[model samples]
Target: MMQELRSRKVEESSAREDVHTAASGDQVSTESGGRTDQLRTSGWAAEGPSRPWCRPPPCFSPSSDVEVWLNRLNDYFAANEVPQDKWVAVLKSFVSDEVYVVLAEEGPTATFNELAACLKKRYGSGESELMTWMRFARRRQCPTESLEEFADPFGLCNAAQTFQRFIDEILHGLNFAYAFIDDILIASKTPSEHDGHLRELLQRLTNYGVVINVDKCVFGAPQVEFLGFLICPEGIKPLPTKVQAVLDYPLPKTYQELRRFLAMLNFYRKFLPVLHERQQEGRPPSTTSRRSRHRSLRKV
Candidate 1:
């Protein structure tokens, strides 16, 4: 009976010890789990919060060309597929002076396209293709001279004289070298001659206190694209891409359109020797013109 009682106590002690071990294991696991969660939270906190889906647009200054700024905004809105109503508010935030005032005063019903049209009428140059070509052609550099500072903004006009006459006088005085607005193209038969001319040009620019964009300057190249023409050992020729713009022009339908097309063609008539003959052949017949002329001649 005593042996049986002792065996029962021993079994009770073993059961309690097993329960204690299980409780300790559970406590350890819970503590470890809590620590893991805390570490995960800290990691996310260190990385910073997630960014919002939509960001504000890049802003522009008042001096910037309104047409250019409007185009950029249009592109951005199209790409983002932003709501049309929000465009005025976004544009207002980026613009000031007359542009801002115009947008602010526009009625609530106004669309972005209407606003763009208003801005275009106010600031667009409306330059014709030929005028644009001439503007570029006026800046073409000769073989010997390389120029600098062609791209100064309006605000810096005082600092750099971007006027055509001023640029022309400077180049004309330099001899063997010339500038197209700000680009200087220096010509020389030998390396030593080129260095001398370049030195002189630099000295002249320095004397006049002209600042050049050094990063844009190219030196000693065998060929360079000046204006729209490419100059090399083979000689100057119209850029194929530029010529393609003319060739790809659609046929004119209206009389006014035909006049404009012919006027543009006249500029290149030297290259198109048979253009006048072709134009005469394409002319429509006049109503009874030959018979009327014959009657008038008989009366005379």
Candidate 2:
């Protein structure tokens, strides 16, 4: 009887111990779970299964249309539920090297809208509505192209020929002045002479119903930028920006890249006489040399 009583007491103690262990386990599990939740809520936890990062769109190149890029970026923000405060940072991250350099000048405190405006002002086509309509009206169908091909609504055919004809008709018999498209350059020996030339040119243009953009017109400037050259009293030179671009160009790694680099250099070849020698050196190996190299490889 004593043995049975002792066994019953032992069994009850074991059951209580088991219940206590289970309760302690439950408490520990709850505390650990609470910590995990707290860490997540405080944003201290590493990105895991619960946390996800959205991939940004392609970076904006200098050639990209800023309005289109902004529209696409806004779509990305809406789809990803990105916060407004983060938009500036996101935009700064996606701009190309050239654009990023310009944006960096704006400093970190600039808002998204401010940055967007800066980009638009710098890169956006400043064509007026009337100019756009005139170009649209002046578009002609090419003889080789079909109606469907020629009817590209967005594309504007080069209106250079039409503009040239118009300029020639208006500025005929003007010896002191010449114009390429809309850019009219009036050369003279004296300020008084230049003034006369300018007046005559303006009167001719006015007679032809040519309304010039006063803001774009530079009057009596000692030096003017025309056709990527700085024309002054002394001599013409390549623009500093164009020279800087040549300096900034990366060394070509492939034949195609080399060709493109050489082509770019050719633009300033008139100013840089040494480029002629460099171009010769940079030219691809001759057909005979290539065949010789192939034969040598085969022999090896």
Candidate 3:
């Protein structure tokens, strides 16, 4: 009986030691009479009772509407056990600079509700119909040139008709001024003549409440960059900025990368001398050989 009691006490001591080691974030095991027992550090030891911590939401770039991003943010908050009051910092971190600017205007001490309200008010429920129309207008199948022809869809659309009417009403007698959808190109022989024409154009615009963005408008310049093209006395050329973008592009290694590089080069093919030679130079030897093999197989 005495021997059994001592053995039981020793077993309890060994179990206590195992618990202590496990609490200290260490895996522990005990062996007695050829039997083994293991204790793994889990729950409280490593993560400390699952306490709430500030978890930043996924990054929201400037591309999406505020409502869509906010919905995602709300989901993140709920999932991460983030409190409503602590959301401003996370929101600021997750959103774009444009969104952050608007938030800042709402004030630094603004609460999550205030931030959300401000975003909703500023960005609206989502993008408007006019905004959607503008996006569609900007899209071009070919980047080389965008021709605004008064054809089928344009003729049929109410927006186009309204735009055409607006142009006709605004510059009814101005024979020198030419307007095409969003682009307005003014031509004059001399700088002085150009200034007069510009002043007249500005006056008409001002009278009609057509506000122009000064940053986007150019007046009496020797060379002007417009619609991704640099226009000068010599000829219209691809913008130097665009050329620099191509130059700064990284060398391609993978098949996808090679294709992307070739596609970009093709955009400015006219400006690039002996583009066919470059295509030949950039083609991988293995790819060319594979194509030759395929051709031979087809013949067979």
TM-score of each: 0.37, 0.45, 0.37
Candidate number with the higher lDDT (1 or 2): 2
Best model number under TM-score: 2
Question: In angstroms, what RMSD does candidate 2 have relative to the true structure?
Answer: 25.6
Off by over 4 Å in 2: 1-158, 285-300
The runs of at least 3 residues in candidate 1 whose Cα sits more than 4 Å from the true structure, single-residue gaps closed, are: 1-162, 263-270, 276-300
- The residue-by-residue lDDT of candidate 3 on 7-76, one tens digit each, is 5654565456546656898542222212111111211101112312111122121221111122222332
Candidate 2 weakest ten by summed lDDT: 98-107
lDDT of 1 by residue, 115-194 (tens): 23433454364423322322222221211221111222233222132233345544556555544445555655566776
Candidate with best lDDT: 2
Residue 227 of model 3 has an lDDT of 44
Candidate 1 total steric clashes: 13
Cα RMSD to the true fold for all candidates: 28.6, 25.6, 24.3
> Backbone collision count in every prediction?
13, 0, 0
